[model samples]
Target chain A: MDISGADLVRAAAFIGAGIAMGLGAIGPGVGEGFVGGKACEAIGRNPDEAGLLTRTMLVAQAVAESTGIYSLVVALLLIFVV
Target chain B: MDMVFDTVSIVKAGQFLGAGISIGFGAIGAAFGEGLVGGFANCSIGRRIGMASPYTRTMLIGQAVAETSGIFALMVSVLLVFGDFSANGVCAWTATLSAGICMGLGALGSGVGAGYPALEAIWGAARQPAVGGQMTTTMLIGQAVCQTPAIFSLVIAFMLMFRNCVGLDVWPYGASLLGAGIAMGFGAIGSGWGGGQAGGAACEGAARQPHLRGPLTTLMLVGQAVAQTPAIFALLVAIMLISIGPTEGTILTSAAVLGAGISVGFGAIGSGMGNGITAEGACNAISRESSTTKDMLTFMLVGQAVGQTPVIFSLVVALMLMFITFNIPATLVGFCALLAAGISMGLGAIGSGWGNGATGAAACKAVAMEPTQRPVILTLMLVGQAVAQTPAIFALLVAFILMFGNYTGPVTLPAAMALLAAGISMGFGAIGPGIGNGITAAAACEAVGNRPEERGLYMRTMLVAQAVAQSTAIYALVIAFVLIFVV
Candidate 1:
């Protein structure tokens, strides 16, 4: 069967969208992991400062996750909007 | 009725199916990765230390963040698979592939990279138990660098699949695809290796001297982040290629892509090496004298950040290449822009790296001699480093102009020369600041180490002095930007 221009274009769009969402998540995911890992380590070492460590970890992780969220938005827009 | 149903059915189904598959798989992968790391970190810590570890929850929470991308991908895929959406050919493929790579690789990096730093931090804590604050900071910074590749991948994937600014035909699609892959792959390599090295150094420092943990950790993070900047820049450029496309009117797109890749790759090398050195120095300082750790760490970080400025600038130039459209008469503009930006950053990196290193060493020495004046010493060190950063910033500003500004009208040779001069000015201008700031930081470190009680006053003074030193560099950037954009 002959592939029309439209089909190819449609296919490209789908692939691109998938890539953006997939790749964007990597940084935040990894970042959060590190933050979590450190927090755990800290808490274990000094249970008294658990509150501070947890707070800092959460704040930093949130910042790291921002980019991932941006990527996700883009992916959804691609899949649903155009 | 049958014809209409047939016409819409296939496209709608395909869209929905594709979205669902993409997000569902992405989420699953991320979740699985986070779960494994979180569980491992918690269990390992529990067994090694004790059952009542507050860190267990925090570790899981951090791990959960890493899972966000997976969740995001899942949501997008579900939306695409289930929803009715308009389809653009290039946009669809770019999006899917970009997302897939981002989440899949991101999960892998975050899981492993985060775990490595966490393990180090735990060991540090176990040893000192007092300097936990400093150890955590250092670990976070290293982890952030490790996460760079993942972030870069995600940015590109998202832009390709979701943003779809450049119609497929605009670029040599094959090159773009290859570029995207290279960007993420190289980025991961740089961050992963760099972070590990820096984190290890920080952990060792914390373990050796619990009191000096804060400063030592800060130095480690700064150095690592600087080292990772180049890789991040490359990723940004690759993403820009999709949106900016190659313009026939100006520089060839191929050159831009190649240049961008080279700049970031090279930048990564310098940053990594520089960071490693800084970390070593900080570690040594901490071991010798824990009391003066904070001052020494601050000085080291400031210097390292300055050293990495060139790489950051290079990334900005690459980004400009990918996004900016310039209408200039000369064919050499694109080549010059790319070359100048790359070379500028490369050269600037050398000066800042050495300068910061010297400053860090000095601070270390000063702190070792006089631990009481730590605060004053740190303030001075930061000022010196800030000044040292001027040249790199200048290079970045000039490169920005060449890449982004529109120079269309017929201008005299003098004007062209002026524009070129602008770049040169910033490049050289950075030298004074670099050396000046380094000296200032050294002195401040010494002061703080001698009179810790006067830390507040000394820090304020150093900040003011550094700001003044940075003015010249800021001026150079403004001028270059103006030359490129305004005149």
Candidate 2:
């Protein structure tokens, strides 16, 4: 099948965007899971310290999730801007 | 929509494939690594509820560190997905794919390796809540070192995706860049794993035996450092590949590029892991046998140095692959042979690295076991390790033939397939002996540790056994050479 060069590039960009975010989410997902798990364990052990543990866990998870966010932004840009 | 019809060819396919691969592969190690750290952190928290604040804080910081590699990977993917490579033609497209492979795969090692220490630290802190600060410090330091490979990958990826590669025209040169990226990306894995293994072991040792903390830290650091050697070699090879590109695309240059990539990428894996294993072993040995710590450390270093043999051979093969310009007739089979030669050598190096690492670690433990038998154990370990390197050498020989040897007559499709098969035969064939040699080294170490006086006998026996092992690698090499002449 004869495919146009520009069309191929455009399609590649869209697919690339999807992959960028989809794959990018992986790092944050795993990273967030880690912090969440640890926080849960901490809270379980010292219920009294749950507040502090939860705070730390959330903060850590937030940071870990940041990469995913960055990826999303890139993906969006790929779809829209690029 | 209009652009799609206007465009003529599917040249951008590599870019899309590369972008997908980059993002997909890049995120994996980071996520898995985070999981490891987080799982341990949770377990540790459960054990020490009171230290939640400190442990949680540290856990967050560690996870943050682990995310860097992923971030780098993301950057490359975004660049690949968004960037304009249409004007650059095949060279640009191939480079994009290499960049994706480099960053995506490169992130795998450091992202995972860094998390290991974080994991161990969280677990260690739970057990020893008082040393949370120290744990964090140590873990971060180890993670920082482990991140080198990823960083190197990033720099190269950025260069590939952004720059025009310093005017190295033609797809063959771009193909070399591809090889360099592959080398850097895959090479980091074993080293990263090795570093994590050492760092995690250190954290555990320090927590369980506070008195041996100093020694454990030293051993862990040293091991991590040693584990990085092969990756460093891969990096060097990569850099060399990048700088020295062929002026024009040729069957020989394209093949060389493939060879260069495999030579470094696969070459680093076995040794890197083996090095980590050594460090972990040393950490364990030092904690139990602190008195012989120095002597044991010396033995570990010696073994690690020896373990680098395959990597060295790989580097040599990579260098030869790049510099030696064999003007083979332009045929698909000839092209395949070039890549096959490189891949075979690179993969074969894994066995050497694996064997060397196992031997080194076992030797370190043996040193701890029989302090007086240091000389004997060291000797036996070295001998066994040498035997283990035969397969790597065989692979290297095949690589040399593929690079330098002149094939007779016009190349045909079957001939090219035979050459590719030859390369595959050698590449896959060498892995067994490489691993087998490690087992032999470990066994020899164990024998010496158990009976230091019987070192001579063990060495002799191992040599005999190793000779048997070498035969396989030899046969593969012979087959590859035959393919070179016949195929």
Candidate 3:
């Protein structure tokens, strides 16, 4: 029932780490989805430029995914390292 | 070790719970926000307006804003669970309330703030489908501005849950929290309203003449971004308030707040005046030669971006206030530094604004006289305005170091004087380059218009000359940095 101050703080930090990772994922996920959808549409419209569209989409999606990855790392750290 | 484990576990659990709540709520908010924008994009309005592409992009951005709150909440939750919140002496209630207030209010502003621009972009696209590309740029710039408030809120929330510098027990924790919130709140309002106005104007312009859409949109976005710079700075200041803890007296704390307000407020003035002038120039150019709208718009926006640098510098100053502590011996020196930095930014604003405005005006006139010489004229204008930006950049660098970098005490009066001199140099240094660059741009524009055949030679010569003109500003910057950091 009773808890030590140190334990409480540690627990708080763990939760914080999780929060950083979890919430961070939302932006990139949506951003990547948008890019992917747009790329697909572009490819469909101009199959000849499929390569170009795919490349651009991939590049953009990668950028979009960065934050999500950051979130993931933070989450992992919280669970294991932190 | 056992005791440590026990303490850490409790905190970790709280952290997890907080993180869950933050991200969960943020996700919900983001989803709803995106859905609204997406729905609009896919709805009859979007179809009628012909902004199907931009509409989708806006929806995604809106979702990003909505999701931030959840992240803030989640971060708070995790901090609660894992972090040593107790050692820092942050009352659990304080931490909780701060987190809640930050996420709740922050998310509210971000959601609405981001949405406004999307709506405007949609409307603009609908009215002038031909200028969709330009409209999209304007929309993004405006949206970025609108996001400032939310960003500010996020920064504050993060500080509360993670940094908690207030544990230093320097100032009343409550005041610090309230102050941080207020700083962010006001910043959001300013950026949101300013960006919205600019976006609205761009939309209206695009609708009126589809041919002029490209240049007009670029002009609007640049203007909006410049306008948003101060708000960004304000947010930075709010972050500082929470992270720096507090000063001894109420007066000093209030002074810090007032200084931040002034910095942002003055920054707004510069952005407003500069954006107005640039926009007007763009409008006139678009009217004269609609076909070359794209090049003209790009040049105008680039010019405005240069013009916005001074305001950005002020924001940097505000951020410094949060981290750098001023003692009695250093109080006067620090105050002067802050004031001088602010004034420097303001002065830099005047130079860049006028310089860029003149260039914009010249570009417009040239395009009017010889529409075929658009490329050459645009190139000249951009080069000139870029040169004009040097002094402002110099001031910014000086201000940044004075605020953030470690400084030796003003041991001797001469040393203190050197600081003051450096500040003065930065302020005055901006004027010459700004005015000179403008004149050169105007000349280049006229020359291109007069002899289109000589456009290539004229542009090359103009760029070379502009680079030479920028040298003096660079010198001033080097000198200022030396005085502040090296000396």
TM-score of chain A of each: 0.84, 0.90, 0.84
For model 1, how does the per-residue alpha-carbon lDDT over B201-255 read when each residue is reduced to its tens digit?
6666766666555665666666666556555665666665555545343334644
Off by over 4 Å in 3: A1-82, B1-271, B293-299, B324-331, B364-375, B404-418, B456-487
DockQ class, candidate 2: incorrect
Q: What DockQ does predicted model 3 obtain?
A: 0.01
Descending-DockQ candidate ranking: 1, 2, 3
Considering every candidate listed, which one attains the maximal TM-score? 2
| Fnat of candidate 2 | 0.00
- Two-chain DockQ for each candidate model: 0.02, 0.01, 0.01
Better of 1 and 2 by TM-score: 2
Off by over 4 Å in 1: A1-82, B1-86, B91-95, B98-111, B128-152, B165-170, B173-185, B192-210, B213-221, B247-277, B280-284, B291-487
Candidate number of the best lDDT = 2
> Can you write out model 1's per-residue Cα lDDT over A1-82, one digit (the tens) per residue?
2446754554344444434533443344334434543454344345567567667866776686676567556644543456
**Error of model 2, residue B400, in angstroms:** 2.1
lDDT of 3 by residue, B420-473 (tens): 545554555555555555555655665566556656555554554455445445
